[model samples]
Target: MATFIIEGGHQLKGSIQPQGAKNEALQILCAVLLTPETVTIHNIPDIIDVNKLISLLEKLGVKIHKIGSGSYTFKADEVNMKYLESPEFKEDGKGLRGSIMIVGPLLARFGKGYIPKPGGDKIGRRRLDTHFEGFINLGAKFRYNREDHFYGVEADRLKGAYMLLDEASVTGTANIVMAAVLAEGTTTIYNAACEPYLQQLCKMLNRMGAKISGVGSNMLRIEGVDSLGGTDHKMLPDMIEIGSWIGLAAMTKSELTIKNVSWDDLGQIPDVFRKLGITIERKGEDIYIPAHKEGYEIQSYIDGSILTVADAPWPGFTPDLLSIVLVIATQARGAVLVHQKMFESRLFFVDKLIDMGAKIILCDPHRATVIGHDFKSSLKATTMTSPDIRAGVSLLIAALSAKGSSTIHNIEQIDRGYERIDERLRAIGAKITRVN
Candidate 1:
């Protein structure tokens, strides 16, 4: 297991670049299976989860070539369909939540798809019913094997139909869109996730000869086509990482510039931080956060209620950055409530912050109330373990602003999302070292 030993109280300055979106990369990488022709993807983040998914695709006989750093050309001319039924494939597929997306493109092209029980961070119950139900709505026969703990979907030919999703799931929308592109008729999806990730997927599919309308709304209409070709797609910068950097700059009193951020695509992220009284300067496509010598303060509602930051669907605050927001709130001038509606256990990591001398009230599994210390007392670093990818980075940010050296174990969780995070932080004058 890898760990990060961070020396706190150092002000980080200069500019840093965010990696390509990890969530979008998972969907785009899996979408490569939809076409037999070569598809080139640029700005691919060199992260563990993405590399694992790429390896899984290679094992399934997709021809992958590394054209350049952060770029790849993939051709699915010959897919090893038989490997889907193998014990080893099941074991490997079960280890990644993104692996479930492969089932969509596989079913669209080959009329069959199989996946073992998928695994990811133990944040909460991440159900696959959304993905499977979307497939079944598209005329695929779905089955769950209780004994082996696997899911399978097959059809002679898929005929598109209307679907109203119970929840606007991001990966679920991507999977269904991939499946519907090659179906026999038009498919209408209501209450779909319209995040930038999904919008990019629709654009990429359109470039590949799939007709999808409503790119930035909840309603998506996909006109089924005979087959899809190939196209090059570039991933947007990671919005979650950008938000994390904003929080890091505020907490550490650092003046930092985040370069090449897709500013227009990041809806409500900057404003949400600004509500916490952080100064955000938009210079062209870049975001500049000035050092806060007096520290940040949380803004209350219009009626003088304590401010509340909650996660909602796209166009609202992202749940992924709530952890970072919570960490930053610890040093702010006022109190705020963080409500994590999607996941049940994500806020559990606040206990570690409490250990670091922050005033936090874990109201429940879903909500936390943070009373700002206003930099009157600095966080005292201690040994801790990373629980998930987002929480790991949030904790790292906290450790960077703490009073002493902090050791964060299980940094492999951090590496799963962020690419060369220590290297990137070091470029901006952060004192972080990676250890085995």
Candidate 2:
């Protein structure tokens, strides 16, 4: 395992570019299986999870070629369906959550798909009922094998129908959309996830000859098509990484410019941070966060109560950045309550912050109360373990703003989402070293 030894108390001041969206890359990469032609994708992030998915695809007989840096051309001309039943394939599929998406495209084109119990961050109970439910609504037969802990869906010919999702799940919507594109009739999805990731997926599918409407709303319409073709696509910048960088700048009192962030796609992210009294400026497509040497103050609600930041569906705050928000709040001037509604265990990382001399109350598994230090007392260095991808980056940010050096073990969690993170931070004057 690799560990990150971070020297704290340095301000990072340089421009950094956000990589392609990891969430979008997962959906787009799996969507490649929907067509037999060559699909070229640009701005793909070279991260662990994505590379694992690509390797899984290759195992299933997809022709992959590296065209350039962060670009690839995938040809699924002849997928080996027999590979899906192999133990090696099942093991590979169980390693990443994104592997669940391959089921949609495989079922759409080959009439069947199989997946082992998927694995990802242990932040909470991530159920697959939504994905399987959507498939069942689209005239597919769903089966689960308890002995092997596998899920399978098969359909002779899918016929589209209306579906009202219980919740707007991002991955579930992507999977269903991929399945519905090649169905026999029109499909209507209500209360679907309308995040930028889903919007980009719809646009990419449209370019590839799939008829889909409602690109930026919760209601989506899709007219089934005979087949899809090859297309070129460029992914948007990673919103989570941009938000993390914003938090890092605020906590460390630095001036950092994030280049070419899709300004329109970052819904409510900047505004949420601004509520914590961080100065964020939009210079063209870039975001500039100025130093907060005097420290920031948490803003209360209009009715004069304690401020609360909670996660909701798209157009609301994303759950992924709540960890960053909690970390940065440790240095603010006032107290704020962070409510993580989606995941129960994500807030458990606050215990590590409390050990670093911050005042935090872990109210429960879902909520935390942070009383800002206001720079009156600097955070003392400590050893910690990264629980998940978001929490890992959050701890790294905290360590950077601490009084002394800190060591974070299990940094592989951070690398799964952020590409060359230590190297990227080093470019911007962050004192982080990766040691094995």
lDDT of each candidate versus the true structure? 0.96, 0.95
Cα RMSD for candidates in order: 0.6, 0.7
Question: What would the per-residue lDDT of candidate 1 be over residues 243-322, giving only the tens digit for each residue?
Answer: 99999999999999999999999999999999998999999999999999999889999999999999999988999999
Candidate 2, residue 150: CA error in Å?
0.5
Q: Name the regions of candidate 2 deviating beyond 4 angstroms.
A: none
Name the regions of candidate 1 deviating beyond 4 angstroms.
none
Per-model TM-score versus the true fold: 0.99, 0.99
For model 2, residues 1-436, the per-residue Cα lDDT tens digits are: 9999999999889999999999999999999999999999999999999999999999999999999999999999999999999999888899999999999999999999999999999998999999999999999999999998999999999999999999899999999999999999999999999999999999999999999998899999999999999999999999999999999999899999999999999999999999999999999999998888889999999998999999999999999999999999999999999999999999999889999999999999999999999988888899999999999999999999997889999999999999999999999999999999
Pairs that clash in candidate 1: none
Model 2, position 42: C-alpha lDDT score: 99
